[model samples]
Target: MITLDLTLPDTRYPIHIGHGLLDQVELILPHLRIPQVAIITNDVVAPLYLQRLTQQLEKHGVRTIPVVLPDGEEHKNWQTLNLIFDALLAANAERKTTLIALGGGVIGDMTGFAAACYQRGAPFIQIPTTLLAQVDSSVGGKTAINHPLGKNMIGAFYQPQLVVADMDLLATLPERELSAGIAEIIKYGLLGDIDFLGWLEANMDKLRARDPVALQYAVRRSCEMKAEIVGQDEKEQGVRALLNLGHTFGHAIEAGLGYGKWLHGEAVGAGMVLAAAASQAMGWLTADDVARVQALIAAAGLPIRSPDFGAAEWLRHMGHDKKVESGVIRFVLLQQLGQAVIQPGLPATLLESLFHSPHIDPALARQ
Candidate 1:
């Protein structure tokens, strides 16, 4: 097992990553403030992991209330969030009751938000089953439910008490789900770690094949990178925004297509390519750089180009992004490979030109 620490202004927590970690209840029990807990999972993940996890907790003498929500990004909204509240209130959970998020990013996000809002606040732990969550979403304190107009429009920055990432859970992930996670893993490289990007290019086949060593290194390193960034700028006051390198474009795509239509990581894969292409047009990145970025994303089995939502429609969705300040949408753009910056007030004409570019491949757009 490998352990990493995230020290922020208001809190400090450990991120534990390894195989079979979930079966060891001792690791989780110490983090809880009380013996009673509520677990928020999804229908799909419940069948696969809920029983075993519950058994482990009960063996440790921890009482649990399991709330199994419908699975998918579409379900990440006020309606589903209310279900967590309903279960928590019905169970008579108190402020000290820790919430255990036992699924992928969707579960982790909603559960964390619930913990943050319930009785003003409560502690929570993230047991992220998907690669995307373990490497990115689960580690960071950003928790949110999707709004109709934008992805993650409703949320909080509530940190988990501890993050228990059991890589063994990934063994059952669907192929597309696994591919979607690689998109976020690649974002770590694009945002700040050029060396990691090279490593990914070299060992992507091993990752895709689910080699244990490759998977472990990918998750460990991704967590370390995120922890460091979050520690430096916990509230996204500055450097932390770099973490959203592909998210702006990705969120726009998600909202334009409707949430859950395209997986978050899949949209990010295509979004990164668009960001790179835009950088190229601005003379910061070369055409070769753009091609390399697209190739790497494609290697992970993610789409390289997005459906052309057109400039006006694209702007409409992007304007709803949380990064927007005073109606000006801030974009996290690449100055070069592995270097990201937040730029706002970009001219609308440049966006229009990029949208009309032939490289976007209309044939590739999903209809």
Candidate 2:
């Protein structure tokens, strides 16, 4: 087990990454303010993990309330959030009742938001079951549900008491979902670590094969990078925004496609390619650099081509991005393969040209 601490200005939490963590109830025991917890999951994850987690906690004399929600990004909304409230209220849950998210990103986000709103505030823990969650969403405190106007527009930065990223849980993850997780891991490398990026390039095959050693190293390194950035700017006042390298465009894809159409990581995969092309246009990256980005994304089994939503429609959707300031949409663009910069007030013509650019076309990217 590799344990790392995410130290914030006021508080810190331990991120436990290993196999068989779910069996170690003692890890969770210390973080609980009370002996009761609400395990929030989805229908898909509940059958696989909810019962086992519940059994483990119950054996320790902890009361468990399982709230199973519908799965999918489309269901992440007011109606679905209220389901958690209903379960908690019926069970007489209180501020001391810790909410344990036992699924992937959706479950974690809703559970954290529920805890934050429940009785003004309550403690929560994250047991992220998906790769994307473990590497990114689970570490950072950014929790949210998708809004029709924007993805994650309505949400809060509510840190968890602890994060348990059990590698064993990923054994059941579907291939598509596994590929989705790799997108975020690749993001960490692309945004900052050149050596890690090279490592990923060399080990993409091993990662695809689900080699345990490679998985552990990837998760640990991704968590370390996120922890460092988040600790420095917990509220995204500065450096933290760099973490959204592909998110501004990615979020627009999610919302414009009506949510759940493309998995978040898949959208991010294509979005990163678009960002790379935009960088090329600005003379920050060469065409070869953009091709490398596209190659890596395709190698990971993710889409390199973004849907042609047209520039006007694209802007309409992206206008709701959280990174916008003073009505100017801020983009996290690449200055180089291993570096990122936040830029605003990009030329309208430049954006329009990229919108119609062959670089974003599926046929060209595929070729």
Candidate 3:
């Protein structure tokens, strides 16, 4: 078990990471001071663990309601968010009602968004089920649905009361999701900590084997690193954007491909590879560094190659990226592992080569 503190300017919250954390939820939840509770999940995740969570809440005498949305990233939008409001209204859930995000990133984002908008903002708890959620989306209070125009554009930066990661539940996750989560784990190592990256390389096999001890350590370290950065820059005025190291490029791939065709982490995994290559091309990193990053990503079951989109279409996708300011596309580049820098003056020739390169093959990425 590992406890990490996320200290923001207004308040601080503890993010608990370990196996069998669901059992400890009731003792932990009441501290949020929520009068009512709503568990937001998806069709896929609800059946697997919802009953256990709901039972725990009921045993604690909490009024619990369940709202299960359709499974898939494509469903993460306003229509789905409306369903949550409908449930809250029907249950007469007030501002004190806490929303529990009971699934992966989608559930966490949607439920948190609903909590933010409920009566002009309520409290939320993150119970991230997937490895992707456990490490990335659960800790940050970035709640949003994908806009037709952009991803996470219409979201609020609302903080959650608590983040509970029940690592045991991840055992039932599909292999692809497990693989996807590794992408974010690797991102942490790539962007900030060379030591953690080295640790991941050493324990990659153990992680795939679902070794409880190894996963617990990985989750704990990742959260601690993120908490430190988020504490320093809660609203993304500076260092926080570094966390989106691969996301700027990844979001473009997701939006272009239409979300759900590729997993979020998978796209980011490939994006990191592309970004690394771009940095190398721009003389920010060595070719050997880019190769090393690729080798590690490929070992983790992530997509190391970009898709084979033409220059125009790729630009069409990347042009809509939210990180772009004044129509200039910006990217977070890895100068090396454990260090990331964002560059806004990326050359158009790089984009042209990126699209034209035969190396960009989605199939090649999908081990």
Model 3 misplacement above 4 A: 362-367
List residue ranges in candidate 2 displaced over 4 A: 361-367
Candidate 3 has a TM-score of 0.96
Evaluate residue 355 in candidate 2 and report its C-alpha lDDT on the 0 to 100 scale.
Answer: 86
Q: Give the Cα-based TM-score of candidate 2 against the true structure.
A: 0.98
List candidate 1 segments past 4 Å from native.
Answer: 359-366
TM match of model 1 to true structure? 0.98
Candidate 1 lDDT score at position 313: 84
For every candidate in turn, the CA RMSD to the true structure comes to 1.2, 2.0, 1.8
Error of 2 at 27 (Å): 0.5
lDDT of 2 by residue, 182-207 (tens): 99999999899989999999999988
Per-residue lDDT over 1-367 for candidate 3, one digit per residue giving the tens place of the 0 to 100 score = 6788899989889898887888886546666566468989999999999999888878778888899999888989999999999998999988888888999999999999999999998888999999999998898778889987677878889999899998998989998899899899999999999999999989999988889899888888888888998999989878888898888778878877878889999999988988888887788789788888888888888878777666677777777776788998778888777899888857788877766564488453343
Clash pairs detected, candidate 2 = none
lDDT of each: 0.91, 0.91, 0.85
Question: What are the clashing pairs of model 3?
Answer: none
TM-score for each predicted model, relative to the true structure: 0.98, 0.98, 0.96
lDDT of model 3 at position 240: 86
